[model samples]
Target: MKPTIVFDLDGTLALGDGPISAYARAIATRIGDDSFGERATVALIAHAAGETSYRDGYHAVATLAAEDRVSAEIVSAAYDDSRALLGTAGATVSPPEGLSGFLHGIVEHASLVLATNAPDAGVTALLEEWAIIDLFDAMHFQVGKPAGLVPILTAALARGRVLSVGDIHEFDLAPAAELGADTALVGPAAARLEVPATMRGRTIADIYERISGWATSAPHTAS
Candidate 1:
């Protein structure tokens, strides 16, 4: 059985600044305030980048904007708009350096799966933009992390050794760890969180290289 590796899409497979900024812009635009958008963008990006929890930053921005009633509908609408923008003219997603080569090298030896909280369209657009859409053996989109990770982990276990890699300790790695999967934490935000992980790297490229080396040394038989 080929070793199974589950990858988080945003901030893990690609830089998330662009899309996250777009979400802030959408929220600001919806509220008809450019200044608010700028501030929200910073706060939201900080949250997405793992500086704070999503609820914390989101509520803080709402409060700062004097919005006493920040409903789920508003947040969802802004997120939907952001996804639309990313799929169209705002598409600036870029794969981590050397990711293409690394994926190609490990594809034959591993089963790669993409699991993300982002909507399907956004995930598809990013993967297509990066030209790695076909590399994944499976994909789960709009997966609410932590709780949403259960199904993904359950499925990957049947394939072989399961490993999860992402930039968020709570959303990406913690749940996977609960399921008994190996985990690799990537990026500076993850370092700041200082969660226990099987491996840690400053960037996705570092994690990729580490996994590649491991796969080489202990190659799995692909089913």
Candidate 2:
């Protein structure tokens, strides 16, 4: 069986600050605070310093919005709206450089899966727009991670070796690591966090060549 490679959509494959900034705007509008952007930046700094448990800038804004007494219902609405705006001028998003070519290059060697906590709001459109939609063998959205990732990894493990790639350690890599899958950590968090991952990169592009190596070198005998 071909090896399985599970990816986190938002921060991993999806690059650029546009979409997340839109999320900040949504939160700010809901919470009646124009300072959310600044606060979210500070929260991200604190996260890098280990002073906060927020996973990323998005998490920071969500937590701060909740702390500002915004209802969970409102927060959910804001998030949904933000995602719906993805790829638009309000929430522009892009894939890493040469992402389409890379995925195509590795298709014969590995099975690609997209697993993200985000709803399907605009993900499909974005992938289709990028012209990489057909590259994936499966795309699973709203995949509540960490715990929710257990079953995805379990099934992949039964087939062959698995590689999970994403930005957040706790939400993306931790569960996959626990299940004995290799992991590739991505984004700025890669600079500070000591995670249990087989590979680390400040951006997915940083490890693309290495990932190509892993994909091509697969023994295809793990199962």
Best TM-score among the predictions, by candidate number: 2
Task: Specify the highest-lDDT model's number.
Answer: 2
lDDT of 1: 0.73
Ten contiguous residues with the weakest lDDT in model 1: 214-223
Candidate 1 Cα errors over 4 Å, as ranges? 44-68, 217-223
Off by over 4 Å in 2: 41-53, 218-223
Candidate 1 lDDT over 1-223, as tens digits, reads 8888899876678764666666666667777778877777777667655676543333446455555344667767887877676645564567789998888889998889998887787667667767788999989888888899988888888666788888777888888888878888876665566467877777888767678755556432211
Cα error, residue 28 of model 2, in Å, equals 2.1
lDDT of 2 by residue, 54-170 (tens): 677688778888777878888888888888898899988788888888888888889999999988988888999988899899988888888888999999999998999998999
Give lDDT per model, in order: 0.73, 0.83
